[model samples]
Target chain A: MKNRLRLLAYPYILWMALFVVAPIVIVVIYAFGSAGGGFTFDNFSRMGTYLPVFIRSFKLAFEATVFCILLGYPLAYILSKESSRSQGILVLLVLLPMWMNFLLRTYAWMSLLENTGLINKLLTLIGLSPVKMINTPGAIILGMVYNYLPFMVLPIYSVISKLDYSLIEAAQDLGASSAGVFRRVIFPLSLPGVLSGITMVFVPSVSTFVISQLLGGGKYMLLGDLIELEFLGSAYNPYLGSAVALVMMIVVIIMLLIMNRFGEGEEQAVMI
Target chain B: MRDKKSRVPGRIFLALIYIFLYAPIIVLLIFSFNSTNSRTVWSGFSLRWYEKLFNDDMVINALYTTISVSILAAIIATVFGTFAAIGIFNLRRRWQSPVLTLNNIPLMNADIVTGVSLCLLFVASGTILGFGLGFITLLLAHISFNVPYVILSVMPKLKQLDNNLVDAAQDLGCTWLQAFFKVVVPEIKPGIVNGALIAFTMSIDDFIISYFTAGSGTQTLSMVIFSMTRKRVTPEINAVSSLMFVFVLILLIIINIRSSVQDKKLRAKPA
Candidate 1:
């Protein structure tokens, strides 16, 4: 019976090898070899030309991650302070939008941010000048923040709520002001959650093609858009696409490593 | 007085954040009822788009594909992932971490990279065999991506499980399989359900991977919605979005209520 139970894993192992392991192996091979089947360094050489794109992707993703932290930290803190019943409902509210189709949510932003859309119309009604919100990097950043804010909030909220309240009371009794208590005690204690939130927001934002495509109006291309274009666009080159994907995989792995370093000796509090 | 004053700002901040989070969904829902196609102008309330949405062949086909793919992928991933979790749990302690890390690779990798890599695999396989990209490849990709989430959710529950219960059941003249089904399965049922739910949502919400692997002929709702963005999307798309939102909201509310009731029952009973 034990042997049979062990045998239950064989099919799953086979499936993982074929679908998960083999696909990534193929990407590495394609990244190294050319379409003509000869080994070449041309793919890596060609990636140098797109260095600016990589920089821009990382920059925008970093900006978006910062915004998510700023906005989400306060909300999470407030939620964690609430009664348990209210906290459950508020957390559900945060998660509700996430369950909606992300493309649809991003598309909704298109209507709200367009020049003649809802925000601009409201601005005109109130005698304010309409700002060009769509088709810009700022708009893409907004979309990223909107879509990923819950991911940022949930982890921090989980960590903050689990914090020992006695520590805060102890600090206050020691004549530490509330601000100092938060900065010195709360923030440091929540570093694991904050670091995980940054990784969660940054990794997806850097690699997102759809959010940029919908909000950036194709004028601003991130690394994800570049990789998609190579595979599915008119510039269909699998080798080049694989090389770009390999680079992205490396960057994401590095982010995961950073997250793991901070999350060390914890119970992996990060969840999507 | 100071505590009350501090509470007001916290309340206001939460209200504003809720507004920010919900504004787009509210606009989408409202637009779904507009008579005219213009998103900003609410000329009058009408269900014309909702009516049209039912007859739109492309939208219906994409919905069919999305539902079938997600359901099939979720079920398969749950079964395999549950057994795989059990197998990993029973392994010698040293081997578990490496195998679990292998499981985490799909969960950790970016969606675009996974999509591109899988596309490369399928395209290569197509050249070797005479098959082309279609529903099968899309289903396979969805299942592959979903299994890791299932494993993650189930592994935690497996760890929390008391293995001695299963041993007790087996010693009571039950076979190993019977002990598993009667004792272990019941204990880990919540995790299995949670894993399946995650799998279903991930499969439905996927776009980048589905876009690459689905090819031109077969499209999920996400792929269709993506293509619709290239043109001036009709309000029918908004109608579909609103319906999907309502469906998911209802499903979530039911789950929340059921779980809360269970929580109450658990609390009411003595530990």
Candidate 2:
């Protein structure tokens, strides 16, 4: 009976083997293969030429992650303090924008950030010089933070809300101030959520092509843009794209592993 | 007094963040009503863009493709995922862990890598299958990413099940298939439903994966928006988005109500 029940999974297993696992295996083979159709280290060896793109991608992703934590932690903490009904509605609102088409959300900013855009129009109205807001590194990072902020907020908010209120009361009863109670009790207990939140924000921000493409104005080339160019754009180098993608896969995996180590087996609140 | 003061700042902070988040969407929504074709200019209040959006064949085709793909992918993923979740649940601890790790690959990896990998797979297979990237590949890739969410959703419900329930069903003269279908499946229906909703949402919102796998022949709604963004965008996109925003809002509200009602039913079930 049990075997028959397990037999039900055979179709799914077959599907994942074809669609998920086999694709990665293909990426590996392509990553190492030469254009002439033999094994070669040329792809890895030429990676140094694109080091600046790698650095910029990581640097921007890092700054975005930091900003998400700074902005989102407070937001999550405050959100958790709300009544349960309000918390549900607020959480939904926080997540609703992300459900909208990603490209539309990014394009909305494009109009606002253009040189003759609304932001500039408002600036000129105040007798201030127009700032070049669009197509800058700052704009790209802003895009990342705005899109991924909910990821940071949701996990930490879940963790903090689940923390034992008795611990906070216990600390206060022992003469710990409110700040001390939060710092020692609430914050430490919520580290797992924070760590996972960091991973969530950092991974997507690092790998986004459209955000950089639309906001960075073809001036700033991140690894995502580089990889996309190698694959779909004029460059048309699948081997090089595979190599970059492999490295990206490795970096994301390593970061997630580090996060999981600190997250202490709290289930990833991925459903939202 | 300190508590009240802190509360005031907390409300302010929430207000500011809400403003930050909604500003772009508000801007987009307002411009959809602008009379002129220019994205920045507002000649007068009009629905010209919205009218244009519905008439454009490209927009209509892409919208059709987007909806069909999302629905098909979500339904298929939910079916496969629910079965797999049960199978994994019943597996030995050692085997289950490894399967779960493989499952997380899609969830954890960057969208670009997943899309590229799948693109490579399809291109390579095209040599034998005689099919390159298009609607088929796009649907397949979406199903791939979406299945993991379904699996993750169903796993928790499986964990919640009483271990001996199936056995009890069998002892009550039910056959193995009957026990499985009539007893086990109904228990995890909520999880299955939740997974489908998540899968649908993810499929609808996905851009990066769809961008890579969609190839040149076909375009999803986001792909159309992307092409527009690359050049000077028309106000027609704004109209499409406003309609989409309302459509999705209504869709989500309906789904939420259905699920909450189901949840209430589950609670009312006698222990």
Q: DockQ for every model, please.
A: 0.73, 0.74
Docking tier of model 2: it is: medium
| lDDT (tens digit, per residue) of candidate 2 on A1-272 | 66666766667777878988999999999999978999999999999999998899999999999999999999999999998889999999999998889888888888889999999999999999999999999999999999999999999999999988898889899999988988777887888789879989998999999999888898999989999999999999999999998987787777678677646554433112
> Model 1: per-residue lDDT, tens digit, B79-154?
9899988887776677678777788778767888888888888988998998889999999999998988888898
Record all residue pairs in model 1 with backbone atoms less than 3 Å apart, i.e. clashing. none
Interface RMSD of each: 1.2, 1.1
Cα deviation at A207, candidate 1, in Å, is 0.8
- Per-residue lDDT tens digits for candidate 2, residues B1-271, read 2457769989999999999999999999999999887677778999988888889998899999999999999999999888888888777787778888889889878888999999999999987889889999999999999999999999999889886998999999999889879988899888998899999999999999999999999999999888877876788889888988999899889988887897899799975
Each prediction's number of clashing residue pairs:
0, 0
Once fitted onto the true fold, the runs of candidate 2 whose alpha carbons sit more than 4 angstroms away are: A256-272, B263-271
Q: Hey, what RMSD does candidate 1 come out at?
A: 3.0
DockQ score for model 1: 0.73
TM-score of each: 0.95, 0.95
